[model samples]
Target: MRVLFILILLANLGVYALGQGWLGMRPEDEGRDTRRFTQELNPGAVTLTPRPAP
Candidate 1:
């Protein structure tokens, strides 16, 4: 049971480190425009909003 708890703790810590970009992992480059044209969402174009709430 103690070993299982330690493994879980280590796994959680690793995930947190990776998510926060720690432990020699390079931080994300913010200068790059990563947006793709194909992924654009146009809900206004497809669905018309009713003037009154239904």
Candidate 2:
């Protein structure tokens, strides 16, 4: 039981160090997928109705 606790603690410490850049983990550059879907979207056809005074 004590060994499991120590292992978990060490794992958490390693993750914290990696997150804080202490372990020299660099950020990865991801490529964006610029493929557009063929769906028709009428964004300029919005009609806003005014509400009556309460």
Mark the regions of model 2 whose C-alpha exceeds 4 Å error after superposition. 26-54
Assess every candidate by TM-score.
Answer: 0.44, 0.47
lDDT of each: 0.74, 0.71
Off by over 4 Å in 1: 24-54
Best by TM-score: 2
lDDT of 1: 0.74
Clashing pairs for model 1 are none
**For model 1, what is the error of residue 23's alpha carbon versus the real structure, in angstroms, after optimal superposition?**
3.7
Q: In candidate 1, what are the lDDT values of residues 1-54, reduced to their tens digit? A: 999999999999998887686875435744545565457686567866679977
Q: In model 2, how large is the Cα lDDT of residue 23?
A: 76
* Candidate 2 lDDT, 1-54, residue by residue in tens: 999999999999988887776877424312533243454478679879899999
For candidate 2, list the clashing residue pairs, or say none: none
Candidate 2, lDDT over the whole model: 0.71
